[model samples]
Target: MLNEGLSARSPKPKAKMNRLYPLLLLVAAAMFAYAPFMILAAPYESTMGLIQKIFYFHAPVAMTMFVSAFVCGIASAIFLFGGRLGADRVAMAAAELTSILGLIVLVTGPMWARKAWGVWWQWDARLTSTLVLWLIFQAYLLLRRFGGPGSDRLAAGVALFGMANVPFVYWSVNVWRTVHPTTTVVPSLQPGMRGPFWYCFLAFVLLYVSVLGVRTRLEKRRAELEALYLAVEE
Candidate 1:
């Protein structure tokens, strides 16, 4: 009897930990997210002009979008092979959030590019590949919404296939000629720029993690609500 009681209690601890994981992640993320802002007024002042300060926020947003897309691919693979409906929902959520972030990157990138390179838009490889990735995620979401029978499977396939562009986007500038700066941080080119760049980078990474966690939780809640609605209708 005691053993049975202990076994039951053991699971309670694990369940509690699982429930707290997201909250803990969010807290940790919040700490890092704001660290850069506490520093000097212009984090990128040493590396690029005042306008270049946007790189800190812009690069992280772009990187986070890549991460989210990669997660979608992983989730899609699990759903397809393991028949995990939860994974499918998670993929959909990540894809949606990634699309939103990608848009922010796209918009901010042009502004930064215009200020630094004197061009608002360029047909550079990196830019083009990034644009493709954005479109792919957008299409995946649309397919999920309007697709017919086997829609989930179709969307999963798209998610898996679209992930191919992620690497291309990351490597485009290196592999091909592009006006987009090669380094995410100006400090990478000049050691003096490292201080503020690192600060900003750390903060943005934390912010991304926090936002991703919140979005993931919202996605789970939305799924539960949908399931409940279907059951009620039945």
Candidate 2:
């Protein structure tokens, strides 16, 4: 009865997701295709000029990274507290994406900084705290990959710490008055710049969601295969 109940319920979510994937893929593809032209048409900043264009990509991807980190942390919390294998799979996928997107933010930040700040890197509160958040998620992935049994729980605990810093990262520039621009920059964007800036933001977010779904499905398949192998061994 338990086996029958599990089998009956499991396919519904997968079936729904299967139908949505194509739509998501199409929309994400269309947005990405059109994004460059939109970006090129926008005016450059007076101070940084052309170099500031990287902000279109950098800010959006960084926002996606922040969202990904929270997703991973929330999923991790669910897995840790509820013992849900499905949530663990999601947490794993989100952690990997966070790490990947965080890398983009880190690299682009330096490139933008070199142009704007006249340095490749700075030890400001914002930069330093962002680095710490990225490192914590990286460590979670490493622990998941290399640590012994029960590592997911340990990694989940670590992820909670990582998620805790999200607020600090955003507020750091304001509180510390660093070389980096404050979070208020986004809201205060000029009329022409705000349109393309937010357009790219939506595009990156959709891309992240589509990629995360695919990655989570892969994790689910791996978990099922592992369980089947263990059943056979028994």
Candidate 3:
């Protein structure tokens, strides 16, 4: 009976592909191709030279990870309070994508740090908080896998709680002194670095949205597949 109840709650299958989806795919591919070149050519060339270009990818990925976590928290809250299954699915999708991007940032950050700071790792506040956030999402995914009947609710709670660290991570450099430089360059609306920086930032944001959309669609499909599998068992 519990199995039946669980299966009943799963979502229905999605429809066939549409025209807009293809356009999104094209845009995603274009951005992926364009981002690396812009990063390499950006004007704020560090003493480390071209290698410092990794900063473009690292910082933007970190920013998008925070955005994803915030969105996940909001969706999780809606799911818990309103019992909205779509919201729950969105939260799950966001969490999964955030985890992936967080891993990318973690890897790229160390590379950039090694070049810029002459160390592969450090115990700075920003680094520590970012790692904490990554671990929380890792734990969230694990709990979902083994949590049994209340998995959705448990994961939703984790998502909401884990996201409380987002602000701390963002402000960590300001909140406390650290070896990591406060800003990549001096702050200005029209700074010398603004051109390539903004272009790279936009490319990354577009890439993130594309990847998130694809992952969410896959999650929805997986939910439908599980539902079908249960129906067959019955």
Candidate 4:
């Protein structure tokens, strides 16, 4: 009866998501093709030279990580307050992506820092805050995996905290003394360089959406399977 009811509900959104999967793949392929050109077209920095190319990927990945944390935090709040299963699934999916993107940011950051700063690590305001934010989300994922009972609430709280740190990470250079660049958006680069950065940024955003869509669908299927198992057990 549960299965029948669920079928009767006929989730039109699932169909739409399925239709969009191939479109996402196409976008990803285009991104891969465009990335090389974007990197090559951008002029090298006077001080950082060719190593500065990492900025194209590093900055955008950090931005995507922030976005993922924001989405996860909001969905977690919804799940905690409204007890919505869909929100829980979305939160989990976003959390997983957040961690993945965070790892990329951390890796790319150290790479750039090593070349530009003569060291692999620093305790600067932005760097430390971003590291702390990544660690907090990492803890959230671990809790979701092994925190056992009552872990969801704890994880939700951690996610919320992680979201709170994002602004501090972004504004740290401007607000405090730091070796990191103040702003990379405008007035920091030549017009030719801005185009590649923006293009790569858009690519990363599309990639995030694509991955999130797939992860959400997998979570939904897992939920459905659990429901079927419970019905069978009964």
Candidate 1 local lDDT, 86-114, one digit each (tens): 68877887888889988998998888778
Which 10-residue span in candidate 3 carries the lowest summed lDDT?
10-19
TM-score of each: 0.74, 0.88, 0.79, 0.87
Better of 1 and 4 by lDDT: 4
Task: Rank by lDDT, highest first.
Answer: 2, 4, 3, 1
**Candidate 3's residue-wise lDDT over 101-165, tens digit each?**
88998888777777766788755555667787888889888999998988999899988888776
The lDDT, on a scale of 0 to 1, for candidate 2 is 0.80
C-alpha RMSD values across all candidates:
5.9, 3.3, 4.5, 3.2
Off by over 4 Å in 1: 1-48, 168-187
lDDT of 2 by residue, 72-176 (tens): 999988988999878888888899998898898899888887876678886655556667778889899999889999998999888877787677766864466
lDDT of 4 by residue, 1-234 (tens): 357436733379878877797698789779869798878977878778787888898888888888888999999888888988778888889999888888888888887778766788755455566677778788899999999988888888888777776776657644564454433221276888888888888888888888888888788777777777778888
Each model's lDDT comes to 0.71, 0.80, 0.72, 0.79
TM-score of 1: 0.74
Alpha carbon deviation, residue 32, candidate 4 (Å):
2.0
